[model samples]
Target: MNNQLPPPPAQMMQLITGFWTSCCVYSAAKLNIADHLKDKPQTAHQLAEATHSDAPSLYRVLRALSSVGVFKENEDHQFELTSLGNTLQTDAPGSMKAMAIAQLGDHYNAWGNLVYSIKTGHIAFDNIEGMSVWKYYEMHPEEGVNFIKAMSGLTGAVIQHVLPEYDFTSFNTIVDVGGGNGALLVAVLDKAPQAKGIVFDEEYVVAETKKLIAKKGFSSRCETAAGSFFEFIPENADAYLMKMVLHDWNDEQCLQILNNCNKAMKAGSKLLVLDSVIPEGNEPHPGKFMDINMLAMTGGRERTEKEFASLFSNAGLKLARVIPTHSPMFSIVEAIKE
Candidate 1:
């Protein structure tokens, strides 16, 4: 007989009610609680007054978080930042503060409407926000800026992993398609000093990129262009690099962008797609969860290697290889013009 016991009911309940813990972390990050406690531990009332929250309620939240090692509860309801909590600081290395803000503030609503997305096969963000997530951000530039910061925080470490693993020396000009803030392109140019770079994005976004490139003293080697990927991309590029762009779109929409890139590519040019590749089976993978998030938020899906190859073939490109990075969740999917 198979002798095994299920987890305790309380443990199962904890798994089911896990969003509460996430919200606690989000609230702490949003209120800048970690930064406040950086200097020294402070009473919950002190933090409450600084953050304009209720003392007792804040104490409850912090106490709950302490159980998860985010913060530590001390004498007199004082709370101190743990190592995990330090990552929520805005200026900390690999900070996730902005991501917490965006996810808890705007994304929370979309996730709440996930059941509707499941039923309708459409994005819950559009239904709840009454506009596409992109349009909503366009209308609210401050939130849009935060959204970009959030993405940068998420992508920054991944860029470090990508820079060393990929070979950019072979390419003369690399167009960073949908490159935000020009960080990736700037990093690429920094490594491959001989190669010139272009940050291709929306008009408003490229305007920001111009400022960043100039600020980074890369104005000479890196430039900016404004356009939509669905319509056209800069032509005759040795490589077109897109990180996390394809996952924001569905298959048909991705084909539109790829077709545009294919039209813009020369015979020997390459297309580099950087995103998560969902592995087959019931294995635990971040891409599997991210695929559902894409479904709820953008009407997109993370794809497997076969799915990626099929997509590339449909766009008249040949899948070259999928290179793994130190970051297990991300990979480089390279293709060549055919």
Candidate 2:
């Protein structure tokens, strides 16, 4: 192809320097960077002073983010909000600040031990933190809330995408397993007036879901159930829905969850596993990296369509179809309780 290629390994350089981007995000999140810049932009020194950090170092970080178009640098060295950076600000319309902070917190450490996860198929978090991710979240309330908020923040628009894609009108009672804060269930029930739903999750977390149900005026039709996914799921449901649930667990445990759903369902019951169906080829999808994140944090792996079919078969169900979304990151993998 080209001849003038004896230079820096740009690809490798990018890979190695990827952590720098993380550092910048963390730096911004830590400085209450987005919060400070919400109403107006400020000088780097002013931002650093307000955040109680070293001025010059903060300036450097801001400049790095500016280079990536997260923020715009003026000739006067004032950093102004760019469109991309505004998404990082905390607010309803566009918010990912919480997510950035959480990922940069405990997740960063777990990701650091990716080799351990890849080699042994064990959660790197357990080895590094001496605690399971669940246990850690239970013990750390603030971080747990932040994580949930982050998830809700990221999945905001996803609610709109789901309503039009799936046929919820055909079903009556839908139970959302591990439904955190009842966001998805709320969305579905709000859209489908004929359908009733239950949000199932742990007692501690389901408390929040109850509040959400009440707030959303879904109290009459939507209920919250406290339960564990591994032990058992409630019986008597027309449809079982699990969104972003399975990928947190390994195949064995995934089967356990599916079987639990199977035991609860009658024939002809629909089972919707809302997750990303890993596509074939190295076509540069973000989900591939998400699969790696699962590997690093939990002993779970994302499944391809064929893998889902096999998995469903193991749980005494048949994979009916995979409904692709406008979102490449997620799909509705439909199965049936047979």
What TM-score, over all chains together, does every model reach? 0.93, 0.92
Against the reference, the lDDT scores of all candidates come to: 0.90, 0.85
Candidate 2, residues 89-118, lDDT tens digits: the string is 777442677888888897899998888887
Alpha-carbon RMSD to native, per candidate:
2.7, 2.5
lDDT of model 1 at position 224: 91
List of clashing residue pairs for candidate 1 = none
Alpha-carbon lDDT of model 2: 0.85
